[model samples]
Target: MTNRFFNFNRAAPDARSDVSFTRRLVSDCVVTVGVLALFGLIAWILPAIDAPVGPEGIPSTVSTDPSNLPYYALRSVFRMAIALFISLIFTFVYGLAAARSRRLGKILIPLLDILQSVPILGFLSATVTIWLALFPGSMMGVEAASIFAIFTSQAWNMTFAFYRSLQSEPKELDEAVRNLRLSHWQRFWVLDVPNSMIPLLWNMMMSVGGGWFFLTASEMISVNNRTYALPGIGSYVEAAAAEQQPDKIGWAILTMVIVVVAIDILVWKPLTAWAEKFRITQSESTEPKRSAVLTLIRQSHIDDLLARILRPLGQFLDWITRPLGRTGSKWGAKPSRRRAGDIVFAAIIGILVIAGTAELMISIARTTGLAELGTAFGLGSITFLRVALLTALCSIVWVPVGAIIGMNPKVSRLIQPLVQVLASFPANFIFPFVVMVFVLWNISINWGSILLMALGTQWYILFNVIAGASAIPDDLVEMTRNFHITGWMKWKTLILPAVFGSWVTGGITAAGGAWNASIVSEIVSYGHHTLVAKGLGSYIAEATAHAEGMKTIIGVTVMAIFVVAVNYLFWNPLERLAARRFNIA
Candidate 1:
């Protein structure tokens, strides 16, 4: 009887295992097919989703109406997803490049600074004409432009997260990876990318919010009286703004708040928690930290399942990343030679790009008179000057205020979300109101344009300062407190220096954003009246609207040149200065 009972129990193990395998296989198939089918359907229908109509038979923007709020919300979700995709690509590439070499880092950091500083308006001003021309007389062009606009709102923060995380990775950890002999691809996919996730996720959340702020301006593009409105929540709010419908605005705001709360609760909180759990305590000296999501995951069956799966996945990753691991390159003494080859290749590529652009511009100018190109370039320079002055002034005003807000954690938390909302608030959302206010108050168009340009990029400084202030070492804070440091002296001696790096980073990015904003800032459209400031943005905006082949091409070319040059001359030097003075790494 005992033998029979033992045999029966032992037999159950093999029998039960087969059933579990079948169940898992079915579950995996269902999940895979479901995901694939859903995505496939979305892809099939996306192109046809334009200019939806209401029950009244009037074609609404992008086939969405206020009455059909769910559809509008879905459109916004789709747009944000696209932005996230682009951001992830750029962030990963930029982050890896920055991590590899200090020289590349130097060039990239400044480049990103300029890119981030330019406003959404500026980006639209430069690109819209080309997009319209590229996809003329079709809804496709409008959709493409919308995607590009979303890219601007999302990419920078992710890049910042990746770059900063890579830069701040512990030295010993890097050494350990080197000892592992991982390949470059392996190292990046396994070590660098995983390490970047926490910060990247946080930045992505912020980017989604930022995209919301700019979505309206992105969807509603007007250049030189030519308007191309795409269907999205941005357009909905924009239309409401035009009509001054306070009720619709209120509804939009309420909806936005709910969406933000839902995202925080359902998505970001859960993902952040899961990532935190994987972050093992590598040091006993480190203070204890609690993650609610981690706690939940720890007690769940899902965690057990994931742990089981990860054992093999981890081994696979280690094998793949072996080439990039610290000792991997040292198998032979040719790494230095290989690195030299990389440098040479990069230099050659850089030269080729410069030569190509120069040749292309010179050819265009030769065919169409250098005088015409020069005239546009000259006007662009004037616009550039205006942008610089405005950026400087705004920086002066906001940097101090940002410092104050940064120093106080409680104040920073309160102001941070508000700043984000204001920063993301679409330029068009306020353009109508600003126009009316300006007309009545007799404000000059220049000032109005400056305000628009300043509005979009100011958050860079505010957020950077806050980040820096918040990151001030706890020991340092205690020291200051013990020493009775207070007042302006405290700010000058402690807070200012502490946040200086963030300020520079933010300033560089803000400066770029301001330049972009200038395009929109320089050009304004009301019911019938359109004001064009005599600068680079207007120059591009006008060229973009004409869609007459040469004007558009020339305008884009000249604008890129000026933008690149401005960064090289101004932002690059400042970035080097900041890094030298403040880089803890």
Candidate 2:
């Protein structure tokens, strides 16, 4: 009877096989075209990046026609893609170093705060000359500067998210790694990265928005009294605004929407779906993230074929990693050896700092004096106050809203694309209109700068908090239900502690971003009216405008000091507290 049953089952010729074969055939054709087109587009754009510069510098023409937007969008996307890759590398190296070593963490975490607060414009202006010297006659120099500027805007948030995630590494995983006696490298690959993946992906998405926030500033380059507006959606929007062409601005908005939608579909959604497997929750989400594109790729015979082709390479990696996994208790460096390495690292860093300080002092002594130092610090204090207040206001407004939205998966899915479009739209494009309204209201530009900075800064808080709230474990939710927990009691016990780490991540980035946004926000121009706020941002901008190198350096240095001080006193302490509370296990 059992033999007959086996024979019957085998004879049925499973219907699922027919459907699978059909789906595979269809997906194979689709994936083939997609891959070809992607590579072809990349091949076409490489020349544009490396094009030789003439006496006029890299060729950049901004066209008003809507038809050209597709090309503009592609160029902008390419720059963003390169920046994101660079940022990921920076995150891994810098964030991992800080997370693994307490001594390095003290230095790097504060340094990261300062870097994120430094204005994009100031960094670009200061470094553009060096980049130009490196690739004197190629567009690649301009391209490199632009990409690096975007990297500055994107990298800090991801690095912070990663560092925090590592600190919050679930105790369960730590025990498992210890049980297996994994090497540092092995633990990094297998445990640390997997644990950080969800938060990192969420931060990566937010970082893309951060990149767009500075797109205009990065794409439009000014050097030696000559302005070069690169061919990108950012420059396109800038041109439209310059010409007072509201119609063109409308078209740019439409193009931006399309580009944002494509990114959400092609990139973030698929990755979000795939990362679900790495989720730390013991109880799986019934309504896990789903991606149509990933599903299609999974159905494709082409994907399977590629996997089969790469199987040997994957196995080779595993084979090599095995030696780095476990033998006994004899792994990692000795205390003396580690201390020796730290001393060498500190020596190298100290040398760099001394050299930079000597050069800065010499330059300032040659140009300005002690009076400018006081002026710069005073301006920095004003800006610091604005950033602090604005960050607090944004937190109050967005934290609960983000938490509510994130707790409901259906709501998050529905609202995610809308938020993406809103976040991806550069608020700088609408600055003139906002300024005009403020002018009409007889508002104080000094204080009103807070509102403008909030345009770009608030989204960081919202995005991070949503990720934190969404990550709350299903078992925790069940526990809350079982206890009939609600209202402030639920929040005090379950919600706040769970999301505190993410909130800190958001708060730090938001505060840093507020400082960065001040460069564009603290000074505004509308027709015949130019309003300037009394802040470090305006100090830097005015200095840059007049090509006052010493003043610019002083203003930037003061801003950096403010950032480092604030982080050391406030954000770093909060992060440590959150880390202590973050472990789910």
Candidate 3:
């Protein structure tokens, strides 16, 4: 029976064989139908549960009842899944485009840096009205805006991961590919993607965590005097906070924890285990990460059955792409044609930048004065200081903890999922509880806001540190033990250096996230009580709420400029230094 399940045999069949085949076919069909039915039910229920659209296209009502938590959690998960799928596609294309062309790479890489630095709140504030206008008097516009917000949260890091992987492809592998004359499509699927899979998976996990961190803000968006609460965990939490119901907030937190654990068990763990094969270093380690769910799926007859069913479609794709693979000409263009294309692209970009700058300047001049400019600059400096201090604090705490956890494979396997769940838990869900404590204790809003930003942003540092430390070779670890390396010496000579590259990556991401989190964290509210911190985030939030277009633009632009400048002067140099000094290869 095991052989029958594992082996694909086509030969003259006896009656017993025929009977077994028929039974297998029936089993496969039943499993497929059951899976489809489950997904179909979810799809059907989501629309039914969504609040009716109002005249202004916002949802008329959103339930905060604990009983509705399951449905709301499902809606949020579904939206995140959709956004993740879109992010994956974009990552592939954008990463490839930037990696393959020098001219495009120069342009695209910096563009990604700027895009990632642009606060999520900025994207929401700028695009929500446009999206609403596009799908007037319908929930579709709001849904689109929410999904896009999530996508912005998730996509940039994934793209950077893939692009870095491609650019850092081993010289020998690059030579082999050139010698083999692999087609562009073939190279991507067979070489680039598989080679990049490990880091890409890790970054993808981080991106999902980020999506969840900001999920509440995305779902319960307030922009330009308009508030739309989508039926999701985010909106549920928002409603709970608004009602000042600690019990409901607790329920939402519990529901989110359960949802996150379920996703890890069913999706991420299986994918992580499966991606082990794609690791570029073929050296066998002492112990590999294991997943019971993945093992069970692999051993199941359904796995073989699905492979058999999908084999024909896979074959058809190969057949259609065969001609392209055979012709190397498809991968190249004439020098003259390439030069012309570059010129045209540059011209278009230049025109757009000039027009955008002119329009922005005109708006700023018309609506913003010297006083407003000074206020924005002052508020921005306050936010910048908070980001810097918080990022440093996170690095100091998590780097050592992450290094310790990562160096122990068994402990890491046990604890990583829990950490990820914590990382993904929306900080906003606990705002009511936070408000209660602060109100009772009379704590400063500024300090409380800093703590909130830390909670939301520190995971980037922790997870990246873990990834880096986990990648350290067994040989290096054994050597360290042989030398009796311990304590601060061990950290300095072995662990810290090993994880430096990852630390830099994490710090950059964490700082960017901190900047983004400010818009929500700097202003805390529960029912009639509100605590406003003095920062750029509060400035932008206030501007957005009042529909002060020029103020919002000025705040967003100033923040973006600061972020981009820091990246260029500080993070970029540190990244290069880490790559040069600490990278194992």
Candidate 4:
């Protein structure tokens, strides 16, 4: 009799048989050749582009012609790809460090919270000069700066997602891994990563959208009378807006929409479907999502080739870490000594925090007087109100719509990719249209800024709600139907509670993103006319543009403090309530 627990299915044909091997080799060769050809094409065209080289060897000018749209889009996508790769690395290292050490997590978690709330504009203002100086005359410095800005936008939320997932790992699985005596490295790959896959993937998708939201600001680097435009869709849109050409703006928007949709179809959807298998639940998921691309890949000879390639590498890693696993306990200090070490670490952190706070206060005191401080606080209040009101409005609209879409699998499959594309649309690209309308209609900057902020932020709520709603168990749905639960009763009891955790998570991210978007949304400019709103975002933007280090730092520091305070007093408590009281077991 076959052992059900450890069956190998020996009846299957050998994957390394002569015919199978030949097919796998051919498939891999084709893939390799296609990738090389694509790279070659990019290399051939890059030098021919008409961007002007500066005395310092950097590209100082950007081409705005419609003909350059494809090249610009490709450059933007490449930067985003590099930033995403860097974000992933940061997420793993930082997230794992925080998760593994309770002592470290106390400082790391709150630090990450503050970092997330810090605006992309703040990063650009602080780091762009440094990056430019680092690279001297090369455009590589500008590229690095732009990529780093995008990284700030994308990395924090992913790190949070990974940390939360790791912290909430199933206790039974935790015990199982410990009993098996897996090394830290082994546990990370076999347990932590797999368990966190679904949430991490969803957060990663949102991070990509967040990166796009800041693309224009990052790529069109303008500060202190100097402007450096890296050839990208962001700069394309900015140039169109500057020229006041609606047709070119429309083209840019269209091109962006196409790229976002393609990425969703080719990358995110398949990854989401694959991640479903990793969900840790007591009852097996019923009729989980299916991806046509995933199915095609799985059935192809290329799959066999990948398996053969990865298998040896995976084995080699395990072998390399085997000794560490065996000798881990021998390397650790005794309990008393370890406790002393933790105390010393905590003391060091405390001293650093106090010193940093003191220095910041001294800097602000020297830079500006009471009037400037009062102005910053008052402007911060305006931005806060906008974020709060817009967040509430977005929740009201998207929560129900997301619930309806998520309840039906067919509808979800059709609409999820569309939502992703919408989320990933650079909200700044539509700023020209908004500015044009506001200018013609005589609308206030206050309301116009709110609308732009909402446009960039609402999709976070929508996508997260969909993910939560989709995870609702079939058995639970059947039970609700069997009980004839309907109307408000059904929503109050079933749907609302089911998606509460996700909604809170989405709200937190959306709120942070809105605060970041304020730097652009609060200060709208079209051609020669500019509308500046009374808010901290505008303050930061103005300060950044003038390269006023003290004012920029003060504005950013005040905004960060406000955001951190709100998160602690409001969002943090709400998240905890949702997790404890509303989450489905």
Candidate maximizing lDDT:
2
Per-residue alpha-carbon lDDT of candidate 4 for residues 1-585, written as tens digits (9 for 90 to 100) = 011111111123342344465555664566567568869866864553333447666544567799889888888888898899999999999998898777778788778777887888788877888987887666677888999999999998778778766766667787888877777766877778877676678788888998898998889887765677888999888887888888998989999998998888778987877676565555555556777655444334544445566667766776797876531244668899999999999899989989998987787788786478778989999999999999999999999988887777687778887888888888888888888889999999988899988888887788778767766767788788899999999999999998887787788778888888899999988888799988999999998888787888888888888878888898889878876788665
- For residues 248-289, write the lDDT of model 3, one tens digit per residue: 888888998899888888778877766766554546556677
Each candidate: what lDDT?
A: 0.62, 0.81, 0.79, 0.79
Candidate 4: residue 79 Cα off by (Å): 0.5
Of 1 and 4, the candidate ranking higher by lDDT:
4
| Cα error, candidate 2, residue 22 (Å) | 1.3
The digit string of per-residue lDDT tens for model 1 on 530-559 reads: 677777777666765664445555665566
Task: Tell me the RMSD of model 4 versus the true structure.
Answer: 4.5
- Residue pair clashes in candidate 3: none
TM-score of 2: 0.90
Q: Write the per-residue lDDT of candidate 2 for residues 262-315, one digit (tens) a residue.
A: 999988888777676666677878777778887676565543455566656655
Could you tell me which residue pairs clash in candidate 4? none
Local error of candidate 3 at residue 38 (angstroms): 4.4
| Top candidate by TM-score | 2
* Superposed Cα deviation of residue 28, candidate 1 (Å): 20
Off by over 4 Å in 3: 1-34, 49-57, 301-355, 478-490
TM agreement with the true structure for every prediction: 0.73, 0.90, 0.87, 0.88
- The true-versus-predicted C-alpha distance at residue 352 of model 4, in Å, is 2.1
Error of 2 at 306 (Å): 5.4
